[model samples]
Target: MHHLVQSSLMRKKSMASSLPKIIRHRELHGEARQLNRMTCRVRLDQLECPYLVEISGVKRLLDITRECIFIGLSNDSRYAVGLLYSFSDSHHSSSMGHDEDEAELNVIVFELSATLLRPVKILIFCYIFYTFFLYIY
Candidate 1:
């Protein structure tokens, strides 16, 4: 019984540290909306296939004259967005248009995580890839 408990703890640690199944990168020119009826009624942002996201009870309003590009999808309530404008707490004017000399880009990451159940799925994928590699060779 003691041995079993130790092994179970080890397994949990491994699962916690295991890498993700897959990852995709910075895409451009798209908008996505999954909003609640109350706070985020007016949906915005050019987010792609976001993972687990949770936002609630937002206050304040402002017009973003400059674009805020979506760097990557949200996962585990974390959204990666790239700011294509200056880092200012104040709103931008539409007349104060784009300038090459002052252009800036940035990435923001908040929270992200994932989990997989059992090794059966991985085994199946490995087998298929192994077969493909053998064929190529």
Candidate 2:
């Protein structure tokens, strides 16, 4: 087995150029004027991607991909779960509303694809944000 430090270095080298670009925030433009847009364009090479990839050096990464904030793995490492939150799909589902309700609370849940590298959609949540919570509790 390689030492932690050595493993880390190898990973860094392989992923250094493949690192993904994340969009922290986004704003919708009105019909009257369109000025605000992608400002987090990284290296200008991480071109817009629609799906995730194990290696991105050759392929473009999605400009708006699901954000995985947390993950939980089984003790035996046989099973895994993750929490993905992203607004990347909003533009396709419908025009983002100016307010919460209008936004339609665009949400999606993904599971690792058969390759164990890319994420595959397992659920597409279309619900009222606050109201959905109320029903749960």
Candidate 3:
């Protein structure tokens, strides 16, 4: 019983020390009503997949200019997102008319963890290919 207690304590210490006390610059965007209802929503058309996230660890959430949203996550939160290959499209916007139209936007929330269950390394290897793709489209 004593051994088990010691092991559990060690695990807790390791977990606490591994995560950051604070993180910064995290943004999630999705549909407005949906964002209010759910923590995770997809709106941006540029990223890859959708993820379930917790927003409690996040420090600040802001809606920026209807075109972008700014998020500040805790250190642990940053590590959580960093492990993923790509985050879902957080938000997007379109204008209907000049001086008469407001764009629609979305908001998303993320779940942050203190420890990583799986560590993944993602690197973009084709800058040239990306540029070529951009030029073509």
Candidate 4:
């Protein structure tokens, strides 16, 4: 019984040491609460049409004109919002362009709320493409 207890304690300590350490910290200045409320709804208006993304309760229409997506709000069509998609690391290479091997997808969301300009929000989505495609097809 003494040997079994000693071995169990040793095994528990080894297992705990192998686990990664997680750091938990609270957001300062109520920024986390503000970020949580900052939600956008995206919908495809029509086939081959621009995407309608409702950001902060405002309806903004976005179109994929070139490599990046653009949005025009209100009468000021000249000052359009742009959404750029870039890889986290440009040097990262992947086989078959799978998300598992690739880095996180960074989406730069630019929008104009009210009269003042808002800060750009960078949304990072880590997609597991292998599991997604496997079940889909």
Arrange candidates by TM-score, highest first: which order?
2, 1, 4, 3
- Each candidate: what lDDT? 0.30, 0.34, 0.30, 0.38
| RMSD per model, one decimal | 21.4, 17.9, 16.9, 20.9
Residue lDDT tens for model 2, 34-133:
1233232243224332564332122435333344333543332223444443333455445444334322222233332212323343343444444444
Better of 2 and 4 by lDDT: 4
Q: Distance (Å) between predicted and true CA of 126, model 1?
A: 46
Better candidate number, 1 or 4, judged by lDDT: 4
Q: Which ten residues in a row have the lowest lDDT in candidate 2?
A: 22-31
lDDT of 1 at 109: 41
lDDT (Cα, 0-100) at 14 in candidate 1: 47
How much does candidate 3 score in TM-score? Answer: 0.19
Q: Candidate 2's C-alpha lDDT?
A: 0.34
Among the numbered candidates, top lDDT falls to 4
lDDT of 3: 0.30
TM-score of 4: 0.25
TM-score of 1: 0.25
Instruction: Indicate the worst ten consecutive residues by lDDT in candidate 3.
Output: 30-39
Winner by lDDT between candidate 2 and candidate 1: 2
lDDT for each residue of candidate 1 in 1-137, tens digit (9 for 90 to 100): 99999999987544433223111111222323222321221134331223332211122221221233435444422243333333322234233442323323333342332321111110001011122344554
Give Cα distance to truth, residue 11, candidate 2, Å: 24
What value does the lDDT take at residue 128 in candidate 2? 42
